[model samples]
Target: MILLQLLFSFLQVGLLSIGGGYAALPIIQNQVVDLNHWLTAREFGDIVTISQMTPGPIAINAATFVGTKIAGVPGAIVSTLGTVLPSFVIVLFLAWFYYKYRQLKSIKAVLKGLRPAVTALIAASGVSMIIACFWPDGAVSLNNLNIESFILFAGAFIVLRKFKAGPIKVMIACGLVALIISYI
Candidate 1:
């Protein structure tokens, strides 16, 4: 039963997560954190962080992690499969469709129209993560702000944008900094 639930939830995520892994964050959150109660918001945030640090797509990583947490290895397999299937089928069909209609203005317009929506999805996900980081308890007050999290975020952003550091390097640096801070 839990396997079925994992499959179904990830199937929905796979089918509707149209833009990319970042854009799929909110949808995945809805299914796992909000709807199923499979993971808390904090755990979801950690999964997102781990997903970003890892190689594979965020949605697939998240599905595997969430599934394993809920129902072990079998759950991970089912969830990962469910998360990938729709993308595989959709991309296969879309490739054929785009190849056949490569010159059509309508197809071009449709593709162009999707860009903004995808951008918005990514932005929304980023904003939610910011909120979660700043206010883990759901209250928006200065007293509740996570100073260490804010410092890590700011420092990482500066290193990535200004210093032009590689993402992996920035992530590792931040992890080390956070670890040291935690020990202090």
Candidate 2:
């Protein structure tokens, strides 16, 4: 039953979450955290972190993790299958459709309009994660700010933007810095 629930919930996430993994964050959070109460907010955040660090697409990784946490290996398989099924079918259909209608002004306009919506979804997810990182208690207040996290965030942003450092390098540096900070 739990495996079925995981599959069904992630199916909705895969079907409805347009744009990509970043954009799917909110929908996945809503399903697992808000609606189903399978994972707490903190657990969801941890899953997101783990998903990002893993090799696969964030959505698939998240589904696998959530399923495993909720049930077991079978749950992981079901959830992952549910998550990718819609995307696989949709992509195949879109590829053929786009190939056939590549010159259509309506298709072009639709794709153009979707860009802003996708950007908004990604931004919303980012803001939620930022709030979660800065305020672990879920309250937005100066007293609740995590200075270490803020500093790490600022340093990472600067490294990526100013130095054009690769993300893996920045992640490694941040991990080292965090490890040092923990002992200090």
Query: Which model scores highest in TM-score?
Result: 2
lDDT tens string, model 1, 27-113? 999999999999999999999889866889899899999999999999999999999999889899989998999689998899798
Candidate 2 lDDT trough over 10 residues, lowest sum: 50-59
lDDT of 2 by residue, 1-184 (tens): 9888998998998998887767899999999999999889999999888886678877898888888888889989999999989988989998999999967999889989989999997899999889988887888999889999999999999989999999999989999999999999
Deviation (Å) of 70 in candidate 1: 12
Quantify all predictions' global Cα lDDT against the true fold. 0.92, 0.90
The TM-scores, one per candidate, come to: 0.60, 0.62
- Candidate 1 whole-model C-alpha lDDT, 0 to 1: 0.92
Candidate 2, which segments miss by more than 4 Å at Cα? 1-79
